[model samples]
Target: MTEFQTQIQAATRIVQTVYGLSVEWQPIPGEVEVVQACIGGREELPIYLTQSGEQTLCICYLWHDDEIEPSRRTELLEAMLDLNIPMPLSAFARVEGYFVVFGALARQSRPEDLAQELAALSENALEALEAFADYLKQ
Candidate 1:
């Protein structure tokens, strides 16, 4: 499996316990977080947020790989439709190889799902995730 696919699988097992929802990854939904033009691409990670032709939240990622050539963020954004990620996938950053990715799980999973998952935790986990979300401005 590719590094990302493996990371995703491993992340799923970890989040199932920490996030409380049982997520099953599926194809990227056509309507959810539509992949607008690529704002950028990187060998590390391309994380960008933009509005649709109608103002809305859309995100795009250009996977980090050694074999790819560098290109302008705008060029990447224009070609983004070809690099759609499953809408519900967790967004994580690996700093020094340790990750902090979580949430947006299961393209169809709702905030309520996360809320319910929080309900199962022993108060502290709930607060921790909440604090993190707060940091994300969610």
Candidate 2:
């Protein structure tokens, strides 16, 4: 297995054992390998991890562009910007058509550290969904 894949596998095991979360390898068609870690079995807000070069990134997709409440888009954007600094290890970002919460660590970080990052990212994602519930379409 490649170094990146091996690191992801180790981090997955750490997350499972330390956090008691379920993790699945996602078959995303791309150069970067991805892992989906389910926080409290809430598959809808699974954290996705990828390692490239010297960094490992964990991301959680909060919602899609079409899911946003049209009138509240500006408010949501402003709120996200305000929350970015105070949200611990995670930050709000737009990836293509999706809104996401993400964290990054050095690629050579310990498995335990990666696990913590995944956990933090997962928590931030849930909080983002809750905080922005009114900004999204039901």
Candidate 3:
């Protein structure tokens, strides 16, 4: 198999083994391959992984949705930007309908590195949710 394919498979295995998480691959027509993993002990969060290109894979977890309540949109966005300031490794991204905390990894990245990224992403995402709740109150 090609290097990209090999790397993808290796990543899948590493995530499963390290996180005790199962990955479901879902490939869309004419798009890069995508995989979904439900993390947390109770499967509380869903993380989406997709190949960013031939050599990078993007790992993303839903952070928040600024459009949920139109009245607070501006405030919510500002809060999100504020939360982004001190964050390390991952950054907040506004995806199609939600804000996501995302980071990219080299296609051939080590399993431990992938695990660290996933752990950091998951932990920070949880913090962001709490921060968003506080932001909405302001």
Clashes of each: 3, 0, 0
Candidate 1 structure quality by residue, lDDT tens digits, 1-138: 433334344544554565554544333335533221211112122222222343322222322332123444334333332322331333333334332323233433343443332222213222323433322211
Q: CA lDDT, every prediction?
A: 0.32, 0.84, 0.63
Per-residue error at 32 for model 2, in Å? 3.0
Give the alpha carbon lDDT tens digit for every residue of 24-91 in model 2: 76546676677666666677897777777888888888899999999999999999999999999999
Q: Over the stretch 13-132, how does candidate 3's per-residue lDDT look in tens digits?
A: 776887676554444345556655555462556566666544454556454464346677788778878878688767888767667888777766775676667666767777877776
The TM-score between candidate 2 and the true structure equals 0.87
Model 2 is weakest, by summed lDDT over 10 consecutive residues, at 23-32
Q: Which ranges of candidate 3 are over 4 A from the true structure?
A: 1-31, 61-67, 134-138
Model 2 gets an lDDT of 0.84
Per-model TM values vs. the true structure: 0.23, 0.87, 0.67
**Model with the higher TM-score, candidate 1 or 3:** 3
Candidate 2 regions off by >4 Å? none
